[model samples]
Target: MSTTPQRLMLTRTDGSPISALVVDDEAVLAEMVSMALRYEGWTVTTAGDGASAIAAARECRPDIVILDVMLPDLSGLEVLLRLRKLNPALPVLMLTAKDSVEDRIAGLTAGGDDYVTKPFSIEEVVLRLRALLRRAGITTDDGDSQLVVGDLVLDEDSHEVARDGESVTLTSTEFELLRFLMHNPKRVLSKAQILDRVWDYDFGGRSNIVELYISYLRRKIDDGREPMIHTVRGAGYVLKPAR
Candidate 1:
């Protein structure tokens, strides 16, 4: 691979440069993550296979790692095990194409901090990275403030969301959408507003991205509970405390 990793000492909002290692056999996916992290002002390194991933981890000692579960040389789980030996407390986010919960368990059991299935959005990746960094002691002045409506609480500092005292797992995009809705409460945010805010202006510009992710949020955030997210007909969507 002729892809040279770009390392920048760019300052984060907290005034610190974060270093990240991205590992995946798919060159395009790896580059996609690297570029996004760099845009977030993180210094990034990329490796195409498991062996190269291990080598890069040892060399850079990134604060966080985004690793593909499927790699040509060794499985991402194996990479995680080897990485743990070097730094057991490392926060590794596992990326996989598999839809199996067992696969997610294996990655987490092997010391991975979180999981992202393949065909994921870049917005999701960046959010996951930010959450991992925050949990790893990097402070975020942005999401650190909490948003609460009734029983649902989003604690940005801890990267945790709980509704009626139960935890909800959300993709990065889902979290952002929910955050926007929570911040605005009862206001109906139009599709265009959602597209511009939750995603990059060009990031999945189709209104369908908003619809698709709303479905995702519904399943996780509103399922098995009274719905807080409501479709406002031709206007957009709204989130109000279920009363």
Candidate 2:
């Protein structure tokens, strides 16, 4: 519920093509990181220090960034703070050698959405980056919505929801999940798929978070009308306009 928009967008290509800045003082590792991102169809730019990273971020305005915490000229945290001032919506993934709980907490508190520790697998890093992007509302498709299913009409850009032509209030998470379901109406989404696509994490992989949120959505979207969201029992949930 306290999630902030990280502002990541995915491209249509099977490759997760994106523009990303990699900031690491170690030239070899910097090049390696850049190459991995490039392998995913991403455009890679490298900066040897925090100062250069900030400058590049301003110039390039990339969709996401990979920042090394131990930069020569400036720390990654400092760079993150300054960069957010420049573009608060910028998505930053911190790279750290420490792997300590304190470091992770600091990075998230200082504005980085996610992090990868030193000597990480290219595949895991890519997955985490994609997860971050998905949570930020980016996907392989480019679709924005402003319409109704049943009596509920939702406007995404405006963060407005209406039932029977009357507006309704919803938490940010609820609103986002509803938008996702509405966009893919009549598609039965399994809980695992929904967890991956919507919540963006495994989250123990057995929690009822999805069911709980769906219940919240039903209350707001179908409290006084024919249910638009239906459970398939052992399968998952689907949103369809009443026939």
Candidate 3:
């Protein structure tokens, strides 16, 4: 039982697709973030340094920005100042390796709407961007926010899950796993695919971790009800509307 995953699309108040500018000196990191944003149905532009970042921002007028605190040419703070001049109310999220209290304070004081330290998960970045968009009065194209398959429901905005109208509490990791499965309902996802998407990195031969989390989901999502999550023998796993 496999099918194409439905794309979750978010757009501006005017119905135009949301856009983002990601500025990081690390080319790979910028690409990863861009890919994640595009997956959410957003248009993404990337810049590797402060000079190009400012230029791209001027051209694209992105709805939001993901800025790195350190850059080869200009400090992220300097870039932030320049960007603010372009759009005072623009939402900016700072990414820094500095996690000290003072460093965090500095980024906030410089007008960053949110701050994320290095070594962060891609999911965290996505979640933070969603919150920023919401606070800025942007919203999904449709009024709907919940992902539904049968009686199971997962609310992206509130981070809540319910099965047959009953709440199901899940740890962050479990929730990410379930969200991945739910995103591709009825699709047989291999262990490698799950590890890459859910974990956001190579798990290095740790397929058992996927099995463990699947069991955890089964306990919460399938227990005491017609099973919706299914294993596809050697291929992988699939989730479908329970019959």
Q: Judged by lDDT, which candidate is best?
A: 3
Q: lDDT per model, in order?
A: 0.80, 0.78, 0.88
Residue-level lDDT of model 2, residues 144-241, one tens digit each, is 22545666677655679987787889998898688767756778888887777666777897759999999999888888787888999899999888
- For each candidate, give its TM-score against the true structure: 0.59, 0.52, 0.85
Q: Please give the lDDT score for candidate 2.
A: 0.78
lDDT assessment of candidate 3:
0.88
lDDT of 1 by residue, 1-243 (tens): 111112223344468788889998888888888888887778899999999989989999888899998899898899999999999888899999999989989988889999999878786677677777667765454433466776788865556888889998877778888877876877889999888777757455568878888899889888988998899899999887877
Stronger candidate by lDDT (1 vs 2): 1
- Number of the top TM-score candidate: 3
Off by over 4 Å in 2: 1-17, 141-243
Tell me the tens digit of each residue's lDDT in model 3 across 24-138.
9999999999999998889999999999999999999999999999999999999999999999989999999988898789999999999999988886798789889878887
Clashing pairs in 2: none
Ranked by TM-score from best down, the candidates are 3, 1, 2
